[model samples]
Target: MQVNLHDAKTNLSRYVEQALDGDEVVIARAGKPLVKLVPVDSTPRRRQLGFMRNQGIATADVKGDFIDDINAMFS
Candidate 1:
């Protein structure tokens, strides 16, 4: 659906709802296309608790200061 700038501004909500319904809406200025409205993927991510609990170890369990060695290389 193509609409003029003024019409897009006036009926913004209606056009947006159309876009959300998987329709492409084009805003025009003097018969030239300026913008296309489309829906954004707003899917939520699922999070897992203790997903890799056994894959990690406590910092105190490390025998040496690993970061100190890397810093020494840059210095």
Candidate 2:
């Protein structure tokens, strides 16, 4: 279904519900199709912390002057 920009803005939630129900939504501007609203991937992307934990990222690897430089710049 297609909706003009103004009406789409007013009933955005309703249109989003429709899209979530597997209906294709096309937003238009001056009768020209602009964008499509579709359902997003419900699956959450997997993530882990400490990307550099094993990449020689210990405190000994950090520059000794790094903290002093940062403090000097911020203070």
The lDDT per prediction is 0.91, 0.92
TM-score of candidate 1 versus the correct structure, residues matched by position: 0.60
How well does candidate 2 match the true structure in TM-score terms?
Answer: 0.58
lDDT (Cα, tens digit) per residue for candidate 1, span 31-71? 99999998887898789988898998776733365678777
lDDT for 36 in candidate 2 is 99
Instruction: Give the residue spans of candidate 1 off by over 4 A.
Output: 45-75
Model 1: which residue pairs collide? none
Candidate 2 colliding pairs: none
- Candidate 1 Cα lDDT to native: 0.91
TM-score of each: 0.60, 0.58
- What is candidate 2's CA lDDT for residue 75? 100
lDDT of 2 by residue, 4-71 (tens): 99999999999999999999999999999999999999999889788768888446734574888878
